[model samples]
Target: MLTDTASLQTVLDVCGVFVFGLSGGLVAVRRGLDLFGVLVLAWVAGLGGGTIRDLFLGITPPVAVSDWRLLAAAVVAGGAVFLLHGVWEDDDARPAGGRRHVTRAVRLLDAAGLALFAVSGALVALSRDAGPLAATLIGGITAIGGGLLRDVLARQVPEVLQRELYALPALAGAALVVLLDRVDLLSPLTAWLAVALVFVIRVVAVALDLNAPRALRSTPTER
Candidate 1:
């Protein structure tokens, strides 16, 4: 069981990084950025969140900096996109069509990545003997921080700010993990169950095209 949990954590971490890196690389490609720029964005999107989480938890060296898995994920993501550049070109890659579809796919992948990172971060925090509140906060931040930085660097609004359900799903997942931990029911199975709940909610919300409350959207003139 312990081994399984550890393996799952590693997988989730790598998967989260991979998805985010892909999204970042895709964004660079959409902007017609150079290969170096794509790699830079991939690295930033993969590592930014865990870097912040580790800093907050005072984990020296940060998993992102210390672990080769993250670096590998970023490299794979950037390389994959760079290699696929020709395919995108051959497809005509209409910005409004191909780019939009790619962006939507990225958003969906991001939601899954968000769930994975939040659950992993909470588990790590709890393992380190942190309180539930701190664990939850760390988890939420871990999930959102990377994408937030990615958006900022790309000169776009962060998804969590513009989209109502993005960060909320992560927070819900983290909270569920903490709750289950308190009840001593939070094994890897339960942790994944929490992730599933978050992922489902997020997917449904996106499919329905949910938005932040009316009060949340800016006025058209503000645009």
Candidate 2:
């Protein structure tokens, strides 16, 4: 049973990896990065989160390092942007509304990937003997860490810090997982339910243009 659960978790993680990898690849292409940079970001965005989680949990060699091929498969899936550049047909030529539509599409794609990482991360933490608080935190971290790493390496502000209600949804999903586990109700069904909840929260946030509170700026005189 344990092995089965682990295997399933891995498959789900791979799916999340592919989604995030595509996001990364798209970002690279937008930034006009060369092929090497595009592939590098895709790989980083796919596995960086899980790598952070494993290292924190004292899992030696981390899955990102040991199970690299799994991440590579995701990068391959993400290579669509690079391989099908012609399909994109040059963004400048597209209408402003069209660009906005694509942006929204990417946000939805990111929400799905975030949900997978958040829920699965909590499960992994629980399996590793982490307490409720730790498991929840780890899960939240797993959801955002890959994008965080990618942004840092790319010299851009992290999305979780600036994007619309990103980290909160991940944390919410992770917390729900912990709650379910506390009640001895955590199962594959409940887990996926948590993922759905996260995704929905993100989608709503996107639709409503929700954002985290911003820091108060000083008055002009104070400045």
Candidate 3:
């Protein structure tokens, strides 16, 4: 039987996969991709992070590949988007707020995926007896890797590399999970709290259009 932590981690992982898949599907729709392209993007965005994480941890044939449910979730998410995108895209039939609604929905899905993946990744690392630093790093990677792959496949700049607080929030959440675990305070409640922290931070960053500081550049000398 799975322990409470393991069970919660599994739930988080599956939820993350679904949300990320939805995000990928939305992106595919925005990019005007075909049905096959939509499915491919969803699959990669849903499973890419977990696959990379498993490989990094030496778990051959990652759970994303070995598990059928995760794959189904991706396919379903993609198909749903492909079928329903027309509803949102019908400008003459769409409500005045339709475009704003779509944007908000996509942001929310991305935030949820990032938060859940961060927590799930940390929990998986902890289960593997990885150190806190490694756990934190893996968690952040797991959160961002899918989006990175999705953006690349869609021929856009990866959000994590952009001047957004995306990766930082994920890393912070993962670090928090590691810290709580180290102190024997890592419970389902704490894990969810960490996820919420990440979500809130990311949403706020997006709403505020926040960016990390860039290096100073010297002013050009007058000719």
Candidate 4:
């Protein structure tokens, strides 16, 4: 007897996981990682956040570990990327033509996945009677943990630290979900609003090339 909203949330959760897994696989292909590496990245990106969420709630085995579907999704995504690379390797021009567009699309989808997972994670935390602050932390971690793992594997600075509007969007979305839920305004509508907020923020940040502040170059006198 799952409620309609609950069911919708479930769908969103799985969809986010699947897309995130696909993004991981895509990146692995671009990097020429082996099949095992691709699948490892895919599973980690797809399930890492949810697993953390479950652990925080003391849920046994974690949802991602317990549910076969999530693993299946990651494996399928990895296999698809591996096979597609085989087909694509024959064409030098095609990679040049499509690589940028595909990368852009993957980034946008990753943003969407982050948004959905952040809000959904907060919602789940709330449902489990977690404190608001704890819920927000859970939400934020769930949103970025996968990407962090992916970056570590790829030998890059994690997205939250180096990328455009990444952590901020997830933090904002999680906070919004908690606030709306507290005010009795968190429903399907509010969830969508939160997602849209995160998505737009991410898109704008990417478009504007927003980045985290770094140490400025020192003058010769200071150096």
Candidate 5:
């Protein structure tokens, strides 16, 4: 019988940030980055999405700046990755297949954070009186914004824009959130249910190597 409240949404938002932050740190580790890079990537990945969402919703100052929990979560995640990754070095004291072993982990974490943020963002938008379509769009943006920033900073192509079923699942979940709210069923239970649905869809797409169809084209000649 859990009810949706400000406290719950805040907790969900924090958890999303922490999880995305971990993925950021992992990406940094995989990229041969230094400690500072790990921290920067982590914070950017964690806060980028929420900041964008807040800005889009016309919320001044953005929670990523005003909230101490977000800062702690991002910093703690970066520190954890730095410490744990060092302990995982192979015989030569280099990271034990940082790319091979950590790549799947990064994708999985991205899926998780995407689901959490999508639902949370949708709920927040609904609470702020956003229209359903606007809420859905905001949710999708909030889910992927962090990863986009992280990948750009880490010098990798963003997964959302290029491949996989990333944005679809997030948008679907946000739409579901809007639906639930409109139906007067947006309780904590339903909120989490939407999260699970989005996560499952994204995870399944990853496992099955699914992708939305792109335009058919001949291979580009050397430009």
Candidate 6:
């Protein structure tokens, strides 16, 4: 059972990396970045969060750096985007709907990546005997760190800082996993459910244009 669980975790992590890499590549494509830039962004988006998590845990060399398979996944995802983006592009001289399609695709992919990484990150932290608070924090970081880096590189505001409900869903999912683990109910099934929950929340939030409350204007003080 332990071996199977470990294998499952590895699979989830790899899938998350690949999905995030693809999302990153698509972002680069939307930004009109060159092929090399796309690849770099893909690698950074796929592995940036994991690298930060590993470093915080004092794991030397970071799995993102040492695991050739993860690197290959990023590279392959980037290459695929480079090869297939032209096919998706509307050859029309007008650029009207083209940007919308790309934006929608990027958001959907980002949501998937966010959900997968959140669960994987929490599981990894639990496996490493991290406390619940630490696990939740790490999980949120794992989900958003890569995208944050991607946006920064692309010269845009990170989504986490925006008015969206992005990090909330990730942290909520991570908290669910931790709670389940505390009750000794942490199974692969439960983990996947957590992932689904996060994904649904994020996607719905995006579709509905939901935004978290921002600071309201203060009323002027009467003299």
The lDDT per prediction is 0.83, 0.82, 0.88, 0.81, 0.89, 0.87
lDDT of 3 by residue, 182-209 (tens): 7888889889999999999999999898
- Candidate 1 has an lDDT of 0.83
- List CA RMSD, all candidates: 2.2, 3.0, 3.8, 3.6, 2.4, 3.8
- Best-first order by lDDT: 5, 3, 6, 1, 2, 4
Better of 1 and 3 by TM-score: 1
What C-alpha root-mean-square deviation, in Å, does candidate 3 show against the real structure? 3.8
The candidate with the higher lDDT, 1 or 6, is 6
Collision count of model 4: 0
Give the alpha carbon lDDT tens digit for every residue of 104-137 in model 4. 8668868877988898888888888899999998
RMSD of model 5 against the true structure: 2.4
| Residues 88-193 of candidate 5: C-alpha lDDT, one tens digit per residue | 5552343445565678888888999999999989988888889989999999999999999999988788888766889999999999999888878888888889
lDDT of 2 at 112: 85
Q: Quote each prediction's TM-score.
A: 0.91, 0.89, 0.90, 0.86, 0.93, 0.93
Among residues 3 or more apart in sequence or in different chains, the pairs in candidate 2 whose N, CA or C atoms overlap within 3 Å are none
Summed backbone clashes in each candidate are: 0, 0, 0, 0, 0, 0
Question: Which clashing pairs does model 3 show?
Answer: none
Off by over 4 Å in 6: 1-3, 91-94, 218-223
Candidate with maximal lDDT: 5
Tens digit of per-residue lDDT, candidate 2, span 1-223? 2335686688769888888888777777767898889889888888888888898899988887788666675669467768875466455576575566556655776788899999888888988999999999999999999888888988877878774899999999999988998887877788888899999999999889898766689343422
How high is the lDDT of residue 107 in model 3?
A: 78
Clashing pairs in 5: none
lDDT of 2: 0.82
- lDDT (Cα) of model 3: 0.88
